[model samples]
Target: MSLPDFSGTTPQERLASLRRSVAGRIVFTTSFGLEDQAITHMIREGGHDIEIVTLDTGRLYSETHAVWAETEQRYGLRIRSFHPDPQALAALLDDWGANGFYHTKDARLACCGVRKVEPLKRALAGAEAWVTGLRADQSQARGDVMAIEFDTGRGLAKAAPLHDWSREDVARFCETNGVPVNALHAQGYPSIGCEPCTRAVKPGEPERAGRWWWEQDDAKECGLHVDADGKFVRAKEAVQ
Candidate 1:
């Protein structure tokens, strides 16, 4: 399928075309990040019709939840929630203990698969197109992000409307549009995720340096970005 042409068009016009084309099959996954707030604002203000949802990993920051509520109240949009399979999570924890991920890369990834990737897979099932807040400048793995691309790993057509946006651009859009954002961003948590697995970045550290900080060189992402292609190689392999 040919991707929607999101070029040369204003954000409003492109959003309208996306809504008309996908109808009810388009959805946005909001993690309550700054970029998400900007995109949600655009979609809501532009009057584009699409489903908005989030994965309830059951471990997000309270600030994230606060923003989630504020975003809904401020925008008057119903954001659906998807959760992990409780039974599966319980089984995994029973077998590996609550924090076993800290012991090994495999264990950490297994936990992510159980708690995040699986739930997201189910949440996105049957959707024709999924939108994200990923930007090329966010990480080494995301440097090649295209505005519209196929997620071969997820079997979904992914749209990253803000792929080329700088952090300042995202902030400017949010500030100019009155979009609600998570307080954690102002607190140095640029990349928000499950609470226990995330932390605040220190001065002069990379934005993601606080995440999985104990693994030395060989670890970074959990598993969400590694899936089928191994687009991101484990740093351990590079050291070897």
Candidate 2:
């Protein structure tokens, strides 16, 4: 599926063009963070025909849920929710016990696979394109992200409209547009993921330092962004 060349176009224009170009569905996955809120505002207020979706890990913070609700109300759009497969989740728990992710990197990736990655795969099925709120400054792993690329893992074109935006850029857009954002950002959480695996990063730390802070070397990805090299592959192919 060849995507439209978005060179020299604004993010809004690019998104609109992408929507028009794709014959199949174009989906955007949001975590309800500041960046996602900014993109959500563009999709909603700009009247782009795109499906907004999110993964419910069943372990998200209450504040995240509040922001999700606020976003829906603000934009008057429904953000589709996907969940982990019940049998997969149950089998993971039975094998590793609850909270087994704390023991090893493989265990942690396994938990994230059940909670985030698998759900995202299901959410993106049949979609010609998937949009995300990824920014270059978020982490070294994402530093080289492009505005558009073919996602080999999911066999779809991936777009990151905020690829060149900085944290301040996202915040400013949200502030100026009155976009609903998660309140955790004000309390030092630069990035917000599932409740247990995320924390507040100290000053001077990387934006994603709060996520899986215990893991010193593993990339801070939840399998949603695995590229050709398969940097953070899931632990088990079959859930059970």
Candidate 3:
């Protein structure tokens, strides 16, 4: 599976090129953050040939849901949503109890594995390209993200159109294009995740300071961005 070296002066143009390059379905997964919203806006407004989808962790903030709905209505597109398996959810609750992720890093990662990463695996099933709204300055783990890379774990090419964009670049695009964004961003939540794990960043904190604030020392990822071999969490089905 060799992918061509795509070229463009802008992210949208590069994305269009990528879309043209792929022969099968190209999926774009959004978390409804500022960066994701920006990418969604570009995908919808440009009318590119790609499928838009999301993972409903079932533990998101109302604000996150609001923005998700708003993006749908604003673009007049129904973004498909994948949710955690009901059986898996019940087993997680029985074993860890609600809010158990707050007690330990392992528990948190397991919760993420069940709630986010597993659903993402389904959402990305059979996709030729997986586009995401990742920026270089987002965090240390993701600082090396290139415009495109092959995800051997998923057996597909992954694209990060906004890889070199700055936070200000995303904000500006969202504002100028009227993209629906999470309301929490205005209240100092530079990074938004599940309501229980995320918080408002303090002054001088990094952009992702709000996510999993209790973990004093860890990368700000939920297993999605990490390499297949270096997954941030262990995704598995619940015991029957």
Q: Which candidate is the best by lDDT?
A: 3
- Lowest-sum lDDT 10-residue window in model 3: 231-240
Taking all chains together, the TM-score of candidate 2 against the true structure is: 0.93
What TM-score does each of the candidates earn? 0.89, 0.93, 0.93
Per-residue lDDT of candidate 1, residues 40-100 (tens digit): 8988887777778888887788998999999999998789998889999998889889998
The regions of model 2 sitting more than 4 angstroms off are 232-240
Cα lDDT of model 2 by residue, 107-162, tens digit: 88889999998899899999998888888778887777777877767877888888
Number of clashes found in candidate 1: 1
List of clashing residue pairs for candidate 3: none
Ranking by TM-score: 3, 2, 1
- Worst-scoring 10-residue span by lDDT in model 1: 231-240
Q: Give the TM-score of candidate 3.
A: 0.93
What candidate 3 gets wrong by more than 4 Å, as runs, is 228-240
Candidate 3 yields a Cα-based lDDT of: 0.84
Highest-TM-score candidate? 3
Summed backbone clashes in each candidate are 1, 0, 0
